[model samples]
Target: MNARHDHSHQREFNLEDREFRFLVSFLSRETGIVLSEHKRQMVCGRLVKRLRSLGMRDFAAYCALLDSPAAGAEVEHLVNAITTNITNFFREPHHFDHLRHQVLEPRLSQSPKKPRIRIWSAGCSSGQEPYSIAMVMAEVLKPSEAWDALILATDIDTNMLKRGADGIYSAEDAAHIPENYRKRFVRRLHNDSDHVQMADELRRLIRFKRLNLHEKWPMKGKFDAIFCRNVAIYFDKPTQRALFNRYADMLHVGGMLYLGHAESLIGMNDRFEASDKTVYRRIR
Candidate 1:
């Protein structure tokens, strides 16, 4: 009886081809994320909980809700469900190392004016990437008051943005942080040893906001570096080309752009010249 009930529930939630295609089209148009035929299962799996939460029995009903005028609010929820957020403190350590040595350190030693450093973590999942960047910035910019340094952490996921602004994480996740940074920038909770929070100092160095890359960006000033890692992979070739061109415009000449290990600008855009592994310097 239990097995039969579970099977029935599963059958009720099956996504039909029409509904899957609608989802693929809606997602691409709304968020610039392309969902191909192979991603159908992944889409279904990820959105099941959203369906269940809305008391939906099938994908057809969910699709109808998305198409209706009432979808304005639900749209946010749908995009959040479809988007993936996976990151860690110093997930790609090499990028951080490059940021320190090639970007920050040289500016500190050679630049005559008060150093002004700006970095954007374009798809910063939660808060880890920017926080890792903040740690390095704070370390290099001695007597922090002397330098104007800031990290802008942006994501389309409001939930992720909130989590990043809160700056709290599981204690075990702290293991990923370098020992020196851990000691200096991580704070133990008053009574909860199971969790930790980013130090106020590091938190002060960052600004978190919800931004869809497909939309117009609000920032006016150019950045010294942009870490858009792992994000362009979700976009199609045309979208990736446009986005890279936009990044080039947002960066200063000789500023750096960091891509995910799987992402490259080889033939995508020539505005940037390769600087290091998965790192490119804006030349024009």
Candidate 2:
């Protein structure tokens, strides 16, 4: 290639490296999503659109802007922009099915304690996971003064939590939801769009918050079940092990931990015994 072509290529490569390193560092610090060297292009491509939208001249300047005093709000936007929040109502049905048929039903039949169920969606993005749990509980557990249930939906990304709290979604977002749930829990928009909002009852049942798994959790009591699916794949082995140990500590004896299909606690900790594929139970 000519000298000018070589210089242009070098500039592009340097910019790509800067963007990749900045994103990897930022994501790891904020949410613990470890991006490997191979993911550099993916990170660059994803953020390039955002950079263009913001009218940034280069990745270096973008990183500098992110370091400013106004960076807190910008950081929230950055995290939301880059993190993959691809989720839908009941995206993984088996976990909820197990919660309903195995955990809740048995507890109701056997326990003498008042019927109270607490579930934490540890990495709930835009609220679908926890809201789905709420929907199941609402259907199975009668709405009464006697029964108590709550779903704590938490994520490190505050922007996603805001969207989740808003409880509005495009019509296509609600497409995969079953007809019964669709009718019972969602109100369709009349603007000829597929947008829908979660019903007041279901929205009330879920409490959304911003939580980082690496930080000290403010939750006081052990939960009956914790849904932290598809969140640990980014952490290294040690982090994963520590996280699972914490999950075990935070769960009631015999409480279940559901992981994503691509994730597992295998060889990480002994406190949880594998109950099934993508599911672990607190044994001790």
Candidate 3:
């Protein structure tokens, strides 16, 4: 029975084998997102909708369309649709906790001059991560005079960056935000369902930009902290190693690197020493 079931599954997937390989190769080459063999069905399932939406009957036709010059814009949409961007405000609470209690507090206390903190949220999807950082900063530094802190939120998807720049969120997205933050930094809308808009002050602190991590980064100056959580998982080992090195160069000595719970720098680079799971400090 098990053998027969396995055979049936293989037969079902055989139809898409070639198209699946093409999509995996195309996406990997273009976006640096590698689709593993286990994700074959997921690729088909996610992109088949796009194929249908584009009026293409089959995956082969969709691949052909992707190869066309006219489809350049469409390719971005396709990648954005298929890529997962699941995140929420304060999703990883401990990281923020550490930043506030461990890093920011000590820097402020030790520095005689007014301290300016810069943080980059490398895969800041829809503004949650960066906004969360801003909210924490607001708590630590008084809003009236402490305006030098900046959070640069960036992502590869322009669609996501636009949403982040708008700073609007549905009620569900605001659930994880603390009540005090929700009241102070977010304005509730009466007519627009249960949505909330980020207050101007908080919004002003975050600068959103579309940044492709695989390409050369245009920003100058080292950041005090960099939150690149969950962004490097799609990249291959070499890319991951190079990215870690670049991040080290972009961070000030003793600056911290926060990664996703599932990610680590083990054997990747020597510039950073592991401070904890998903956390590293620039040592060199």
Candidate 4:
């Protein structure tokens, strides 16, 4: 019994060097994400369940399947498994504050004739960032009937997209929302006190979709502001450079680009000038 348990454990957890290299290459090619040597164990842990579900005895079999024609259906599952989705409601408070003060507030005086406003929450994991943006939009663009505003929330992970579309979160998750906004935009489900749903008004202002940044973007119109925070940390410099260039092309002149706290474009791109800490403006 002990020997059998040991063999099963080894088969489940062991990630061979050759298999790891193949996965790294495949992930980079498909998703533009570079998995380093240090991530080997994490890859092993994340994919073990996949192997079990497919009756795969080892990483070698999984890699073979991915390399085969049968990989089409498995590709999405692989992407969903390995992609990290760490986010929370109002994770970075300052970005929302900036959006309210610099991006949305100024629009109040410029055009009451239904001025268009578009904000993209790229790599919007589990929907918190976009919902937070919606809250601020509701607060700043008062009488909400007058503004042509929309938040495009997108992520490569379909599971996360579903969660974002559902707009339901735990009380703990909703705690980050300010009390005033909570009172107005959070709905408590009867017989459930631990979880709450985002109000319809906020949901009405957002659209969630699956978007892989490595591939072509289908969005045709230019955006006024983009919140792509904390997502670039996964890509290599070349990928990051290309992605930022695309972002610059997608934004209008003087439009805002909000990045993660740890990310910056100092030597990466010249099209943007820093507007605040980790925040940039497309300057042509």
Candidate 1 has what TM-score? 0.97
Candidate 3 clashes between residue pairs 3 or more apart in a chain or in different chains: none
The TM-score of predicted model 2 comes to 0.87
List runs of model 4 lying over 4 Å from the truth: none
Model 4, span 1-284: residue lDDT tens:
99999987886669999999999999999999999999999999999999999998899999999999988879999999999999998887888888988889888888878899999999998999999999999988988888899999999999999999999999999988999999999999889999999999999999999999999999999999999998999999999999999999999898999999999999999999999888899999
Off by over 4 Å in 2: 1-14, 49-55, 66-70, 111-113, 190-193
lDDT of 3 at 15: 28
Q: What tens digits encode model 1's per-residue C-alpha lDDT throughout 1-284?
A: 99999999989888889999999899888889998899888899989999989998999999999999978888889888888998899988999999999999999988767778899999998989999999999988877888888999999999999999999999988889999999999999999999999999899999999999999999999999999999999999999999999999999999999999999999999899999999999999
Order of quality (TM-score): 4, 1, 3, 2
lDDT of 3 by residue, 96-213 (tens): 9888876788877876466788899998988899999988888887742644688999988888989999999998899899888888888888789789888888887899998778
Could you tell me which residue pairs clash in candidate 2? 171-194, 171-195
Q: What are the models' TM-scores? A: 0.97, 0.87, 0.89, 0.98
Provide the lDDT at 247 for model 3: 98
Please give the distance, in angstroms, between residue 265's alpha carbon in candidate 1 and its true position after superposition: 0.5
Cα RMSD of all models vs. native, in order, equals: 1.2, 3.4, 4.5, 1.0
Task: Encode model 2's per-residue lDDT on 168-235: one tens digit a residue.
Answer: 98888788788898888889767757678889888878899988798789999889999998889878
Query: Which model scores highest in lDDT?
Result: 4
What is the TM-score (0 to 1) of candidate 4? 0.98
